[model samples]
Target: MTVALMWEARAVEGRGEELLAWAKARVLEREPERRETFRAPQDRVLVITWWDAEYDAKLPELPEPGDELVTRTVHRWRFEAA
Candidate 1:
């Protein structure tokens, strides 16, 4: 089975570009099967990675940025192909 992991965060104020760059640089370092990144209006950045493993398998995730870089806590989700 394959698992998809999604990670998202909102920059504190005017740091959306910084946060997005940081996420892009880190999200794929572990080298998953596939990955993509996105930006939302409210300084939100999202990264989704597809791994060729079971849902229960461990996977590397985008690490948290500096506390001052984000407004709220980062969010993550995992899903297995149905």
Candidate 2:
């Protein structure tokens, strides 16, 4: 099975660049099959990692960034390939 994990965060006003840099620098304990990062107009950063594992299997994920870096708590989601 294939599982994809999504991590999204909204940066504090005017801190998008810093937040993007921070997200790009994070390294997972185990490398995923694939990973991608994206940003939006509202200072939102999104990271998606694809893994070769069952939906409920334990896997490495990006940790939350510092509170000062984000406007609110990070958002996460898990999905299985159809």
**Number of the top TM-score candidate:** 2
**Cα-based TM-score, every candidate:** 0.93, 0.98
Worst 10 residues of 2 by lDDT: 60-69
RMSD of 1: 1.2
**Residues 1-82, candidate 1, lDDT per residue (tens digit)?**
8899999999988999999989877734479988999999999999999999988997888888889899888999999999
Tell me how many clashing residue pairs each candidate has. Answer: 0, 0
Report lDDT per candidate.
0.90, 0.95
> Candidate 1: which stretches are off by over 4 Å?
27-29
